[model samples]
Target: MHTVVIGGGVVGLSCALALAERGGDVTVCEAGTLGGGSTGRAAGGIRAQFSTPVNVDLSLASVPVWESFEERFGVDVDYRKNGYLFLAREEETAAAFEANVEMQTARGVDSRTLSPAEAREHCPQLRAEAFVAATYCPDDGVADPHSAVQGYSRAVEERGVDVRTRTPVTGLSPPESADGPWRVETPGETLSADYVVNAAGAWARRVGRLAGVELPIAPRRRQATVVEPETAMAESVPLTVDLDRGVYFRPEREGTALVGGHFADADPDVDPDDFSESPDLAWTAEAVERAADAAAYFGPETRVRNGWAGLYAVTPDHHAVVDEARPGFVVAAGFSGHGFQHAPATGECVAELCLDGAASHVDVSALSLERFESDEPGTVEQNVA
Candidate 1:
């Protein structure tokens, strides 16, 4: 239990590979470098099409560890299952996608319900009069957030766990036995650590005020757009989405295409080196007029050749705090931007909340920090960014 995991992205290298595979001598400190923040500008949309139920049980237990990330992390995080549609532009978002496809098929999640002529059997450049309903799923996909954090930072530093790149924690606090361990601070250097896991994406509330704890977290600046498809399309093609706006797109490799978070947010200012990615060209011209009749790259000469800007550590309800703010301080950041597909169930729930304090995987006791002081909904994840 000599933990220290701070932030190496992909949910702090999947929480230092589940606290060094439960042996716990992990280290991982990364203040910069290594798929930097928001897992290196993620648009890596892997999905369970959640609306809740602990985010569809953290994408159904993180889809068999992202389908065994290249046979257990050798590499190749190109895990593209090619499926995830979601469009619905009317009748109340198609009756909330018919109650979220009957609650993602009662939680088994292979979801369905298309019509817009079965979403052209999975996007034949959809535009079926611009979505009246579409839900698909097939298995939900996309990957390669820096090859899944370089395949979980080279298999969690070979289970010894000292990833440390540039080491900039700057402060953490809580020592002298609140349960011991955690003094941290860094620039020159300092350390203590019995446990201290705040996977600081979007600076987890200024690293929780260096440990006095304010952590309401806030970052929210998303932008993505990678298209190059003049027309060849299907590199498998899935992740379509139009969900009344917050745009989306997929397929990218050669006949590229990788749209953006259509819109509903983006304020920016929390500059961790600010990659303001400026392309809200009036929200991309109102997402090309609400994704022009469904969208085949919403014509009018579809452009946008480049884009980048990511950061969504929002909190105040978009859940993810992960408790124990005292007792050696823990608090897996604000994953309001869906921390890289919930990095394998937040690395087995921050290694069972740092070994046996709790974490039945998804209970996360509602992800604590006392639910922002009794508002009652810590880790409040209501499908964000």
Candidate 2:
């Protein structure tokens, strides 16, 4: 079957690679350069500490790929398993962490709850007295998204897949008949495909409209800044998160760290094409201050060196919609902000949906777009940063 995959970010490239691996004719259409969207701007966090089972399952299915990416793809993605530490200041949030750890433990994730003192053991600079409780997962970590994109892009092209960069999809339509091919129109030419996979990242909602499907994906801008800490941070320091404040920081190098968070009560959606790519000065100052409050490594002398902003394809429930929305159109977007880490599993599922008519790798039944139209839309992932 001829399958046309839209978007050339890590997720889209992954889907195209999976499709080609399954002996399907695949063509990847990217509006911009590969990994130029959310994939390139991602903080590269990988974790299985989600509150939802589906998300954890996605991590379970994908992390193994990341663990062996260098050997399998012949590309070094700078994969680091420095771990992720989540802090809770409120009693209710601490109780939720306990429940989340229990659930995570049952799913084979080596995560455990920690007292404030025990949390300090993992992160020496942490202000233990400031937090009521914390959670730590030694297996959860990060990798370079750009490197992963290079790996996947090369793999797909090697498999004889047509990867069209700078080719924006102008129109998309469902098949006219039950067995007719789907129409995908680009500026240069129109192509017909047996299947069309929408992996458009931040522009997913717009792409969905072209196919006459209304996806609840919104583009929300998130920023991260690199700061030179007053005190040298250990390169092995785990990605520390002040969950209550939505602030997080991870060691980037010998003495510098990447810090980010959304401090406002409201996270309004922004235009994907018009939003600022550079971080806001006010937000960067607040992010650093919040980081300083969480750990001693960041102080009044912390200097912000550089920063950039990216969009998150947010759904109302903060989970992805990875289902066949129409007869031959599949959606693998609206991952909130976890798309980069979950790309492998999502790609496998999208390929399965296109070939086997059901996803066998991960149970994506809860992530269907129809869930939004129903009364019980399910839970929203609380561990977003």
Top of the candidates by lDDT: 2
lDDT for residue 271 in candidate 1, whole number 0-100: 74
**Local distance difference test values of all predictions, in order:** 0.76, 0.93
Residue-by-residue lDDT tens digits, candidate 1, 118-146: 78777787878766778788898888888
lDDT of 2 by residue, 109-147 (tens): 999999999999888999999999999999999899999
Question: Cα deviation of 145 in candidate 2 (Å)?
Answer: 0.5
* Candidate 1 regions with alpha-carbon error over 4 angstroms: 1-3, 8-30, 33-36, 44-47, 50-55, 59-103, 108-111, 115-187, 196-295, 298-300, 309-338, 341-348, 355-358, 361-385
Clashing pairs in 2: none
Cα TM-score per model: 0.35, 0.99
Cα error of candidate 2 at position 219, Å: 0.1
Query: For model 2, what is the error of residue 174's alpha carbon versus the real structure, in angstroms, after optimal superposition?
Result: 1.3
Candidate 2 similarity to native, TM-score: 0.99
